[model samples]
Target: MDAQLKHGLLEVCVLTALYKEDSYGYRIIKDTSPFIKISESTLYPILRRLESGNYLSVYSVEHNGRLRKYYKITDLGKKKIEEFLDGWDEVMNIHNYIVTETRRNENE
Candidate 1:
């Protein structure tokens, strides 16, 4: 996948992950890795950006005797999700049309 595409999609994936419930940094990394190739370094900056944007909020909780920061989506995050969904729909539609047209032309 293109780096740009990965960067663009990461935020959407992160927000969606948090939509169900709050999660800590490591857990988020673990969950997202299977779906998207993300680095721990890359994810921290994105998390910071989201928190600064008020799309997500974080608080620390002790788990396994370690202080872990848990993130949850805010109302702004929900709005962002809606926006991402609309954008994804458009991207998919365009991709499908192009692929279909290409196949049709090839068959001619």
Candidate 2:
């Protein structure tokens, strides 16, 4: 995947991960791993950006002998997800156009 595209989608993926439940950094990466290629370094910045934007909230909990930071989606985050979903139609339309055009060229 293109680096720019991957970066763009990472934010949404992280938000989606937190949509259902609050999760620590490693857990979020694990959840998103099945779909997107993300690592701790990449994910921490995304989490920070979301929290800075008020799209997510963070809290710390004691687990084992250390503190684990967990992220939860905020109302703003939900709205951001909705906005992405709404824009998906346009992206799909562009993808379909590209596919159709490519097939046409292949046939010709």
Candidate 3:
């Protein structure tokens, strides 16, 4: 995927993952892997950005005597996701236009 496209999609994906449940960095990577390729390098900055944006909140829990940082979606995050979903229709429409237009021109 293009870097720019992936950047935005990844942010939404991260938010959605937190929406499902609060999770730490590695867990977020694991959860998102089924849908999108996410690694520590890719995920950390996104997490930081979301936390900074107030879309996510972070807290640390001691697990196995280690501190694990967990992320939870905020009200702002939910609102943002709704906005993304609402805007998705336009994206799908543009995709449909490209696909059908390409096919039509090809058949001609």
Best candidate according to lDDT: 2
Q: Please, what is the whole-model Cα lDDT of each candidate in the order they appear?
A: 0.91, 0.93, 0.93
| Candidate 1: C-alpha lDDT | 0.91
What TM-score quantifies how close candidate 2 is to the native fold? 0.94
Off-target runs (Cα >4 Å) in candidate 2 are none
Clash count in backbone of candidate 3: 0
lDDT per residue (tens digit) for residues 13-108 in model 3: 999988978988988888889999998888988888999999999999999999999999999999999999999999999999999999999999
Tens digit per residue, CA lDDT, model 2, 1-108: 999989989999999999999988998988989999898899878988999999999999999999988898999999999999999999999999999999999999
In order, how many clashes per candidate? 0, 0, 0
Tens-digit lDDT string for candidate 1 (1-108)? 999988988988898889999998778888888899778899989999999999999999987998889999999999999998878788999999999999999999
Instruction: Single out the weakest 10-residue window by summed lDDT for candidate 1.
Output: 24-33
TM-score of each: 0.86, 0.94, 0.94
TM-score of 1: 0.86
Residue pairs whose backbone atoms clash in candidate 2 = none
Q: Clashing residue pairs in candidate 1, if any?
A: none
